[model samples]
Target: MQATDNVTLDNCADEPIHIPGSIQPHGALLAFDIDGALQAWSDNAPQLLDLTLALGAPLASLPLPAEVHAIAAECRDLIEDGEAPAIALEVAIGTHQFDCIVHAYAARIIIEFELREVPSDAVAAFALKAHAAIDRFKRQKSIDSLLQLATEQVRAITGFDRVMAYRFHQDDSGDVTAESLRDELEPYLGRRYPASDIPAQARRLYIINTLRLIADINYRPSPLVGRAGAAPLDLSHSVLRSVSPVHIEYLQNMGVGASMSVSIVVNGRLWGLLACHHMTALQVPYSIRMAADVMAQVIASIVQSIEARERALMAEQSAAVRTRVMETLLHHDEPARALLQHAPALCLSLQAEALVVAQYGKLMVHGDIDLALAERMVASLPQSGDEIIERSALGDWPEELRDALAPWAGMLALRFDPSTSGWLLALRREQINTIRWAGRPDKIVRVGPLGPRLTPRGSFDEWRETVRGRAVPWDATARLAAGQLLGEMHRASVARHVETDRARSQLLAMLGHDLRGPLHSINMAATVLQHGGAAGTMSTRIQASSGRMERLISQVLDMSRLNGGLSLGLEKNLVDLVPALQDLLDESRIASPGLRIVADLPPALPLMMDSDRMMQVVSNLVSNARHHGAQGEAIEVTLAERGDTVVLEVRNVAPPIGAEMVANLYSPLKHTSVGNVHNRGGLGLGLYIAQQIVHQHGGEIAYRYEEPQVVFAVSLPRN
Candidate 1:
């Protein structure tokens, strides 16, 4: 005997249930080798078949009818070709009829015979009902509807006391989703069963053997008598395989005398079961059982179709959101800011309670979250890779993080790209799940006919279990959508880097070209002073060249600091903005002799600001106007106070900026030649740096084209 034949509570999972070495007493089993010599026979075969058996006698020597030999020949060919499970036929022996099932395995032919009194009309009647049931199934609009109708039809066709449509969850637990029962029976709908009820090995058998029946739980088992040193038969696909003792005990405890289950296999996986139970021993004929099996297969197909359609719809919605986010990234220079603008929509699409984006060393969050706490969560993730981390509950988190993740239990984090130091997180709030199980799942050890073993629990009363600190489990579709979104985001990030590199190359080219003139002028002036010719003029020329170089280098440095996420280091003091503007305009006229600079200023509009930096802001705006404005156009500068707000406006007359240039106005190292009269030669960092500086002073800056003039405006609070 195998070690699992005498199983204990701890080793129940190791039981080799497929090779039980026996068959249920309702049928008789016979095995013959290729030479037609009887090799194995069940003990009850003599009484059930009314025949005498010999250990090594050929099947042609037996008293069985000649028809049996002819049918067996056809079955051997079909089995060898993998065409069907087995060939079933009704045969007569003297005055009795039996359902004969024949198949071949290991070069041996196995046959099972079960006595039946089926009438001629039964087959035609079941076929008609089966066709009608399938026609109605095609009308079902949803899976639940189809399943409920299926349970009703199976119960009607088999005359069972109760039938239930059960579905398995990702955790291996099952729920009775639909049921059809007699009016007097108690309802089992909406009840749940724990994963322990169906062990892993049992589930594997279910997938292989689609239909199983136990005529009577109390019936005795008939042991197979084999030749000496015969190997135990593998009865995984046997029609009359005996049920496990523990499983029989389990049904007995549920007050069921006979039971049947048809597996619902979807895409090669066991999705659920069609369970039927009888209050008393009731033997269903093989024909009716086959009909029930066909119904189950139909149900599995319909379920797969409906679920696929729903998942496709969800994917379409997710794709729409992805498109919008990608467009925002392409249009805006700052990815973090652009993503934050669509946080609400993204959270909704992902079915998440909150969202966090960490990119470019900046943290952006939505839905009432602390920045420091979010940073901590980001730090806990691996520094690189596109690995995804998913957690369904706070209890699943590390002990140190459990308390911190309270109220927010589920987390789906994606570290999409190794090239970028960033993470995207979608969070769900804690949801308390209340489950009502059919019984307490824990088994009790008891001494029974088989020695000490774990027995099924005697009580099957309704048991309620409260599960805490968990959100609704994320389904496979949601996880797939998350992966798709991250992939798109990674691609967009790579594109941004490529564009930035191109801009840097352009800046290097422009700087090299512009700096050459200043250096050449300085060298020429130095040589003139060395010759002691025009000493004052050479000194003046050198000072002008040095000033130009200083301005260009300063602009580059400011842009670099802003790009690195560093502060401008403002030193604030209560200052008069009116004087700052006047000084800027006065310096503008001196630098550009032909350009007319006009100002509109209040006598004294005082505010808190860094005087030098604030002046630099105005100076850059004026310089940009001078370079890009129309020839001989007056540059207008205005400063005023409007109810606790100080306003600054610089206006220049020029043609409207091109749409492409306007879109990338604040991007660094841009070069554009609008017209011959307008001079645009610089690193293109003036507006970008000016915007950053104004943002540091708790102010707003914006640009607009008003008819014949292009206007740049800055607004700061007067405090």
Candidate 2:
């Protein structure tokens, strides 16, 4: 199957190139149906195969050699078994031997013949050369060194004028990454070729064929002779198949007579090529070609091994960075602020030109980044996706934002938190390159023997072009590093929150326990003063202050227990809630005489609940309203039954809570303020404790601001 997307041969001459209905003059092709009847034969087949045959001629009827007949029979059986076999062997006809390649494709059997002129020791020589190359490959440490070694080995093995290890870029362009050429020849090393040089269709063919050889660019293409009305022969698998005329012209323009390309496929994708060019027509025997194929496979495996090791090393380094950053974040109360100090290190580790961290409505940038641009980039990020969004080319970005990105050509943004609008963005600067093309990359339309069509450029001299607006494309390693850092950041944030909460809970528990003794002694002294008939205003004030202190300590201890994941120790009973509300309101009114409070209660409503805990809930809510409500406004408490549930609403006239504060409204120890409504007094735990108490009773507590009134509604099931 052909590869798709950007490399598709659709609407192009690639499809026609696959079945060109011809073969090169240096070889001959004969195609047969599954039943061994001659379907097609190249015009040169008679001269190369030493046969006098016509279309529809049976293999047994033809005057071909017996070896050809035996190979055809073997191929037929394999084809019948649904196995496409590419078998190569030596065959002799009229005292002349030729290399015969046979393969089956789509129920058709193709036999290709090439003249073999190698010495008797050719195989032995190739084996020694290949073994030495393999040894050198094993000793190479880096990919560049391996590629250079491969080029040298291939050039020595093939005897080509120039051997280049060409690498394909993200944009399909190619660079001569490593080269081995004759000393007197001009070096094409380090030269770049536009993607158009090898059209998408040709690249596809390279992947399927793996080895392509053009023995002579000047060789005439002998058309296949077949029935006039029959479909053209499919020579996609023909070893002696004729190549595209445009490519032949392309090589001729560069003054190249012979060329061969061995594809370097990594992980099943065409990665690059070991391209060999000779100044004169040259034919490499099948043995040498097979040896080259083995070398290419070895090179591909080594490339994969090297890349995998590099990725593993990157993962190890990224993990170390994550640990250091996470520890720093956990140590500081303000994680975002702490992260800013390590942004430079993070940017370096990510191989980024700059790094921007957006957290809790703030932007912190490291390296050469404009603050305003960073802010705009943060705003451009999607608010909700957890997946990393990356683009290596600035052209892939929105046109409006492209200019603003300026020197930066790539952006990688990831939003780690779904609840907050923040992102971790890594930027890469433009790699502005000066490309030296082997020829002018532009293809022109001109009249040729094939007719008016796209023709190859006539120039082969170095054509220099400046390329910009691209970066040293981000790879999987960068993505992995970014993801790892964000994951650790998330984990560390949770850990820090837990640690802070734990420490606060511990302090409150200790303070509450220590104050109990002093509070109890004060209460006892007040009681003695009252009993001695000397209880004056001073004694009354002392008793009231001590009582308030005792209530505050009790709330602190309760909040501490709740924060520590301990459940409330409640005593249950089937009791009426009206009396409890009334008693709580009476006490609240007595305690805060200046503050007006009112209640709307049903006379008798009984439920299965902890009556003391129920009183605590009501008292906490009432206390919250009294503390946070608008001055001179009355606190309204309503207890009503609604079908299967009872709703207790503590409504007070207060300013609306800010949206930001509302998220943490029921959180313990949060000091929330909106406009004039300040959250002051009493440890900020009343609403939180009330919420937990309601939850333990299989009920829910909710808060909403309705115009001038803030409502805290507690709903419980009426069993």
> Which candidate wins on lDDT?
1
Q: TM-score for candidate 1, please give it.
A: 0.86
Residue-wise C-alpha lDDT for candidate 1, range 126-183, written one tens digit per residue: 7678778988988898988998999999888888999998899988889999999999
Candidate-wise lDDT, in order: 0.81, 0.79
User: Weakest 10 consecutive residues, lDDT, candidate 2?
Assistant: 671-680
Q: Once model 1 is optimally superposed onto the true structure by TM-score, how far is the C-alpha of residue 570 displaced, in angstroms?
A: 6.2
lDDT of 2 at 560: 60
- lDDT value, residue 309 of candidate 1: 89
Best by TM-score: 1
At residue 462, candidate 1 shows an lDDT of 86
Model 1 weakest lDDT span, ten residues long: 673-682
Candidate 1, residue 70: how far the Cα is off, in Å: 2.8
